[model samples]
Target: MTNSHEKLRMMMIIALFAALIGIFSQLIIPLPLVPITGQTLAIGLAATILGARYGTYSVILYLFIGATGVPVYAQMTGGLGKLFGPTGGFLFSFVISAFIIGFILEKTRFNISMAFVANIVGMIINLTIGTIWLKLFASLTWEAAFLGGFAPFIIGGIIKAFLAAWIGILIRSRLESAKMLPKKATIS
Candidate 1:
C-alpha cells in the first residue's frame, strides 16, 4: 500500500478508535472519588495493540474532542473546564498513560499476562498523576484523596487491568494467526 493510503487508513482507524473511547467513556458508575467507565480499557488495549505512535495519537484525539466540549468525557460532559474539574487529573493523565503503555510494550517482550500487567501499570500512572492533582486541587488530605480517587476503585481497576491484558493477548494471538504478526509475537 502507498504511504498516502496508509496514512488515510491509519487516520480512519485512529478516529474510529478514539470515537469508541469517547463513546464508552460514558456509562459512569460512581465509585469513591471518580467515576468508572470502559474508556480505560479502550485506552490500554489500544495502546498495547496499536503501538505507541498510533495509541498516543488516538488518545490525544480523544482528549481534544473532550476539551472542545464534545461531551466525550466520563458522565457525558466535556469542555476545557472538565480538565480542571474534580476528576480532571485523570483526564490529563491519559496522555502519559497511553504513551507509557505503548512504549513499555514495544521495549519489553511481555507475554499476554505481561501485556495486561503493562496495562495495569498504565492505569497506575493515570492514578498517580490523577490522585496527586486531585489532592492539590481539592486541598484534600491523603485519606480524602484516596477516598475520592484511588481506594474506591482498587478492585475495579484490578478487574479492568486483568481484562484488558487478557484481551490484548487474545487479540495478539488472533493477529498472529492471521499472519499480521510474527509467530514469535507470543513470546510463549
Candidate 2:
C-alpha cells in the first residue's frame, strides 16, 4: 500500500477502535462506587492491534467524544462531569494503560503469555489510579476506596484481561499472516 493509503487505513482503524470502546462502555454492571464495564477489554484489544501510538489515540478519541456529552460512558453517561467524577481516574487511566500494553506488545515478540502479562500490568495501573481517585474524590478511607473501587472488580478484571489477551493475539496473528497489519505496528 502507498504511504497515504496506509495512513488513511490506520486512521480508520483507530476511529473504529474508538467507536468500539464507546460501544463497550455501555455494557455496564453498576456498582456503588464504580461500574464494571467492557471498556477495559476494548482497550486491551485496541492496544494489541494498533500498537502504542494508535492505541493511545483511539482511547483519547473515545474520551473526547464522551467529554463532549456523547453519552459514551458506562450507563450511557457522559459530559465533562463524568470525566471529573469519582470514576474519572479510571477513565483517564485508560490512555496510559493502553499505551503501556501496546508498547510492550509492539516492543516484544507477540505471544499470549506476554499479552497476558501486559494486560495485567495495565489493569494494575488502572486499579491503582482509580483507587486513589476514588479515595480522594469520595473522601473515603483507603480500605473503603479499595473495597468499592478495586476489590469487587479483581476477578472480573482478571477474566477480561485473559480474554482480551487471548482474543487479541489471535486477531493479531491472523492480520499479520494476511499481511493486512501495518508494518510499523508489527514485528519485522
Candidate 3:
C-alpha cells in the first residue's frame, strides 16, 4: 500500500502539472483554427508520467481554474462562459484524454514505443470528442468538423504528441532512477 507521504506527493505533482500546463496554455502557438495551447502536450505528459489518478486530476484542475475566472485558457478566455463556448468541448475532452493516456500507461509497461502509441491514441480520442462537441454546438456536419477542426490540426497534433511522449518517458525514467516511481509498478 502507498503511504500518506507518497499520496500527498502525488497530489502535489498533479497540481503542479496542471499549473505548468496552464502556464504553457497562456503562451499562444499560432494556428489557423485555434492557436496552439500546451494543454495537449501537458496532458499527455501528465498522464504518462503521473499515472491516471493524478493525471485526470491535473486536467480537471485546469478546467476548474478556467471556469473559476482564470484567464489561462485558450485565447486568454475564462469563466463558466468559456465552458459553454465552442471551445468548451475541447476543454472537457482534455480530461478524457488524460484519463485514457494514464490508464494505458498504467496498464502497459512504460517504454518509448508504448508511450508513443498511448499518447497518440489518447490524443485522437480527445480530438474526436472535442471536434464532435464543437459540431453539436455549431451544427456542423461530421465532414465539416473533420475538415474544419481535425484536419487543420493533424500535423501539429502529431508534433505535440511526439514531444509530450518523449518528455514524459524521459521524466519517468529519471523518477524511477530516484526511486520516486515504482520499478515494478510499470510493466515493460
Candidate 4:
C-alpha cells in the first residue's frame, strides 16, 4: 500500500476500535458506585493490536464520542455530565491504560505473556484512578472508595485481563498474517 493508503487504513482501524469500545461499554454489570463493564477489555484488545499511538487515538475517539452525547459510555449514557461524573474516571483512565498497555507490548514483545502483564497493569491503573475519582466526585470516604470501586472489581479484572491477553494475541497474530497489520508495530 502507498503511504496515504496505509494512513487511511490505520485511521479506519482506529475508528473501528473506537466503535468497538463503545459497543463493549454497553456490556455492564451494574453496581452502586461504579459498574463493571467490558470497556477495559476492549481497551486492552485495541492496545495489543494497534500499539501505543493508534490505540490511544482509538480511546480518545471513544471518549470524545461519549462526551458528545453519543451514548457510548456504560449503561448507554453519554454527554459531558457522564464523562465528568463519579464513574468518569474509569472512562478517562481508558486512554492512559490503552497507551500504557500498547507501550509495554511495543517495548517488550507482543506475546500472550507480555499482553497479560500489560493488561494487569492497565487494570490496576483503571482501578486506582477510578477509585480516587469515585471518592472525590462522590464525596465518599477512602474506605468506601476501596470497597465500592476497588474491591468489587478485582476478580473480574483478573479474568478480563487474562481474556484480553489471550484473545488479543490471537487476533493480532491473525491480522499480521493477513497483512491487515504490519508484522511489527510503529509509532506513526
The candidate that wins on lDDT is: 4
Instruction: Please report, in order, the local distance difference test score of every candidate based on alpha carbons.
Output: 0.79, 0.90, 0.79, 0.92
> Compared with the true structure, what per-residue lDDT tens digits does model 3 show for residues 44-163?
998888777678888898889889998878767789988987667888888888888877888886777878888898878877887888788878888887776677777878888888
**Two-way lDDT contest, 1 vs 2, winner:** 2
TM-score of each: 0.88, 0.96, 0.89, 0.97
Q: How do the candidates rank by lDDT, highest first?
A: 4, 2, 3, 1
Worst 10-residue stretch by lDDT in candidate 1? 179-188
Estimate the lDDT of model 4.
Answer: 0.92
Any idea how many clashes model 4 has? 0
Tens digit per residue, CA lDDT, model 4, 31-138: 988888999999999998888888999999999998899999988999999989888898899999999999999888889999999999999999999999999999
Regions of model 4 farther than 4 Å from truth: none
lDDT of 1: 0.79
What is the alpha-carbon lDDT of model 2 when measured against the actual structure? 0.90
Model 2: per-residue lDDT, tens digit, 95-163?
A: 999999988887886788888988998899999999999899989999999999999988998998898
TM-score order of candidates, top first: 4, 2, 3, 1
Worst ten-residue run, lDDT, model 3? 179-188
lDDT of 1 at 29: 88
**Which residue pairs does candidate 2 place in steric collision?**
none
Better of 2 and 3 by TM-score: 2
The segments of candidate 2 whose C-alpha lies over 4 angstroms from its true place after superposition are 186-188
Which candidate tops TM-score?
Answer: 4
In the range 1-188, model 1's lDDT, one tens digit per residue, is: 56676677668767877997898798578776678888888888777766667778889999999999999998889999999887888988888888888777778854677677788888898888899989998889988997788877677777877877777668756755765533332212
